[model samples]
Target: MVGNRSCRIAASAGLFVVLAGTAGCGDEPATQIAAGSGTTTTSGAHWQRLPDAPLSPRASSVMVSSGTEVLVIGGQDTAPCPPGADCAPGRITRDGAALDLTTRTWRTIAPAPRPLLGEQAVVIDGVVHVLAQNHGPDGYDKPARLLSYDVATDQWREAAAPANSIGAALTSSGAKLLAYETSHEQGLVPDRILDGGTWRDLPRDPLAPSFDRVMVAVGDERLILFAHELVTNPGADKPSIVQAAEYDLAKQTWRRLPDSEIIGGWYWSHTDGLLVDPSIGGADGGQTGNYGRVYPEGGIFDPRARQWRPLPALPAEPSDDLWQGPATGGPELAIVRGFVLDPGAGKDGRWIRLPQPVRGAAEDPAAAWVGDRLVAFGGTVHTDRKSAFTADTWMWQQ
Candidate 1:
């Protein structure tokens, strides 16, 4: 649990403080970037602790970087609720803040229009589009809403909402924003937002039904949808089946890829192909309660050849006890457990183990590639319970 130290900085004002020699801040730690025959590579990257964010301790916060500032949005905070009304233990916060990378300073931003939890934010053009979930006094069963924030103006606006209440998976293909949802009733149809407000379904062929799916953008105008369907019959041969297809935005059509042995799990897009870590729903495999495991091999998917190629196995095996704790990376590299793998660096790449944060190990924190560095912030620490929320922020740069 985080200590009760109040974040004393003024709201909506920049707090300038020299971060040198701050407690819990460390100098650049050593890193090894290696390249060889199908092995992990080492790099000279290290971690640096930024000044503490001027906000109460929280977790599950959505962090998005635009220009030189990184915005920290809605999250669940440990602060107690106001006295007179019935409320959940800890309240949801609509407050937000910004960290100026150029100046190494922190400033509070305008609070969100509404309180949201577990929402996802993506930058299209110069604005930040947040797919917000409306959890009123009743609870989180409410429909999801779309909200847009202008970083230049520090203003928020409500956009046209999706057709369904369930939130959609959001990603960008060039300047276009793609939102996909696998509904049992509506089937599989993806919506694209080109100008940032209106969303129209992409014209395509019928998609197969699946227990769950993962989508990633390939190149500037193509997307790959990986679907996994479970075998209902007890006497069936395999536990589940995995299928993939590519969508061409130019033609607005879907073409089924040749069936290959690829496991569908969390994946990050890379220059060569898609780097996949075959772990599901955190380290504890908690997503098994909803979407059962489909495939469990870490590999790469080449969109040009339409073939699946296996990469070297990850150094840290999937943990059965941690929830959503698999290694995650962006376009350039991947971090499994604490080890970093840069598959795109060719033969000069090797797996580099990251130094543990001064606070402790991060439990599935939200991270984003901001310019030349990766900024990670606010995740659970001790147990899977909500009380373990943390607000510590760390950065990794080569």
Candidate 2:
């Protein structure tokens, strides 16, 4: 069982107010706020706290928005490991919840068929497709199942399973769902395209093995695939590389672009453009992981030019804690970490840091564009000794 000390503090008013004596599980207070009743912002963007999600604190949770309703899917609610024991499975959760963006309210939804952790979800034609792992009595080993949830009906049904057990990436082009899986036999990644609810293998050139990749629909006819080199042997020195390619659905062929100067990093795609946060290089000449540094610099990839342009660095924050990027989709706004960067504004785009609702180090919080606002939901927070999942929800608007 997890310790109570790691339990999330329940906010009475649907807002997380930082109390004088109260602190997060971290060394410092979870949030930094000045005395005020109004929301705070550094760049004119406003932050508003929403009702707490009914589900427990979780990380690696998948969230997708269909119209005005946002669905929070299964994630790991980790507990402190017992002394000398390993935390492999770490209390994976099967519960699911939904947040109504218009009313800022939450309601419990049907739970997943099984506990799911580290799964990927995508919304297509108002349905959420969840690619889950198949877990044995021991732990997740292979691609287990594909589940679909209809937002209007609030019901789930099984979809056609992929060919491989491990899902690499999932995205949708218009009404078609494209799922990528790792081929254990050929040591390559293959594409599984969904047609009329069934999955069909798409013919493609052999690609290198990559567990971390991003697929974004450039248009109705082209899908851009960004592949990254993974460090198979953790702690081993490896060079950072990012490859870009575009797949023509009509011609059924892939075209590789010039190698990107940007290293493997997080990507945020909007109707206007794509933003990439490159891995930061440390003093040891090593690339820092996503959580390692607050990389002040980022770049915007122009698909038309097939080139990347530099984006100005973000303003310094009190903590060097890193933020993951391009969370929400909007033509004028971009969210990195918890801050909103408006590149469409004045001469150079400006970065506005928003106040945190649940502090500590939020890792991999799922965010979606809801109407005019961006809703950020559940992520993990790391303390000195232990880590806790969070069910807090916050919204940002200009």
Q: Model 1, poorest ten-residue lDDT window?
A: 10-19
TM match of model 2 to true structure: 0.72
What lDDT is reached at residue 397 by model 2?
Answer: 68
TM-score of each: 0.75, 0.72
The lDDT for every candidate, in the order shown, is: 0.58, 0.57
lDDT per residue (tens digit) for residues 165-268 in model 1: 36376777887876766433334445555454667777643345553555678778888877554334311333233467888888878898765454334444
lDDT at 258, model 2: 59
User: Candidate 2 clashing pairs?
Assistant: 143-165
Q: Candidate 2's residue-wise lDDT over 1-398, tens digit each?
A: 11001111111111112211113321211222222223334344444667788988766667777777888888777663333445564677788889987777888988887677656678878888877776546444555678888877878887557766464567777788888753223356568788876777777633345434667787777887765543453223333445567788888888886555444334546434554442222112134333232222235566777876555444443233323443444545655444455554444445555445433445546676664566767665555666556667776665
**In terms of TM-score, which candidate is strongest?**
1
- What lDDT is obtained when candidate 1 is compared to the true structure? 0.58
lDDT of 2: 0.57
In Å, residue 212's CA in model 2 sits off its true spot by 3.7
